[model samples]
Target: MPPPILVTGGTGTLGRHVVARLHDAGRDVRVLTRHARPGESGIEFISGDLLSGRGVDAAVAGVETIVHCASSFKGDPEAARNLVRAALRAGRPHLVYISIVGVDRIPMASPIGRTMFGYLASKLATERVVAESGLPWTTLRSTQFHDLILMVARKLARLPVVPAPAGFRFHPVDADDVAARLVEITLRTPAGRVPDIGGPRVYGAADLLRGYLGAARRRRPVVPVPVPGKGARAFHAGANLAPDHAVSGRTWEEFLADQVGDAPAGG
Candidate 1:
């Protein structure tokens, strides 16, 4: 049998899918989590915390590869550095880190950019950690997930009129598609900083809001409000898009369809 693979954030949105895929493919898989449930067949769960470096070494012990899907908006850089240290001490396993697109392109002055600056900055720091760790590593940058987009939009749809951020665009890829790509990457040798993975199509904020309203059977008007900031400008300039690497097949509409169980209420 091949060496076991360690998966951090195994219970997370994307990590769970990767774990499922690896398990289905009959690979020996171990997951690191803060809480490990008992009697879980076919998966070895280790109690660990990446942010504090607890049990990380134990999690990496005898593992050949690590699919790092865990991240925090507040403590990403520290968490990543800790993970890198643990992995290095454990013979430098192949590390796969998931990142967001436009981490380098989005200016910090924009509203959206300002709000995400801390998270993006931390991710950048984490990327640097992996790159300079002298370890074989692959980092994949993916666009926003469809579920995230809908979650925000759905919340906004609760108002009488949904307000869309002006000049903002999104390329919302399905989480499952991103997970599959991560799994594929993990199965192969590490490829450093590959091209980004984007959704099948791009949609403006208003269109996304309208889609949410339609799905929830809400007749709220999607008002395009001027969210003028450096962030909005950056997004308008296509900082959020991966025009060269739109590889995913699932569209936001299809995701919405799945949630609604048919076509949206009106269309």
Candidate 2:
């Protein structure tokens, strides 16, 4: 019998897609999660916590590849540390990590790095741990997800007038597009830091909100809000874009049409 392909955060936005693809391809899957879950056709949910190192070693046992997709707003670096330690003890399966683009260039170099770009710092710190860990590793840096942008737009639209960050732009990619690429990578030998992937087009934050409002069949005035700090400057300058490496993905306009075309009025 073949060993199961382990996926962290297998229930999350991106991890679920990875799990589905792997399962469809006839690969048995093991998911490390905080809650207990019933096993599926070819999927087994293993109880583990990456942040505290509890049950992580058992999850890593007998695995040949690990698609690490679990992440939090905080403690990402610590979680990676725990996973690395366990993988080493279990003979070091190929570690595939999903990270965000521009983490290295986001300029999180201060005592207050965690204030504005805390998530960026967390991802960067985790990247360092993965790179330095002595295990055979592959890291894929990707742009923001379309689902994330939609969530932000929905929140901003709740206000009578949305405050758009001045000069903020993102090249958002579809999560499934990223997941497909990731599964392809996972099926192969480790490649260190493959090319970055992004959406089909770049859209300003306000433009994205406008797209959402249009799809949701609501109207709201958008006002530009000035932002400070080098971190903000980086985002303003398209630090999150990957034009040269854009994936053939679902466009923002298309995603809005699918997800928001049926939203409640003013939702």
Worst lDDT window (10 residues) for model 2?
A: 258-267
**TM of each candidate vs. truth:** 0.94, 0.95
Over 4 Å off, model 1: 109-113, 265-267
Across residues 1-267, which tens digit of lDDT does each residue of candidate 1 receive? 888889898898888889999988888889999997763567899998989899999999888799999876688788888888888889989999899898887677655656846577677778888888788999999999888887898788778888888878988898888888898999999999988999998888888888877776778878888865666677789887886888657788888889754546433
- Model 2 C-alpha lDDT per residue in residues 113-227, reported as the tens digit of each score: 4588889888988989999999999999999999999888888999999999999998999999999999999999998899989988887888877878888888899899987
What Cα-based lDDT does every candidate model obtain? Answer: 0.84, 0.89
What is the overall TM-score of model 1 with all chains considered together? 0.94
Shift of residue 85 alpha carbon in model 1, Å? 0.8
Candidate 1 structure lDDT: 0.84
Off by more than 4 A, model 2: 110-113, 262-267
Error of 2 at 44 (Å): 0.5
Kindly give the stretch of ten consecutive residues in candidate 1 with the minimal lDDT sum: 258-267
Best TM-score among the predictions, by candidate number: 2
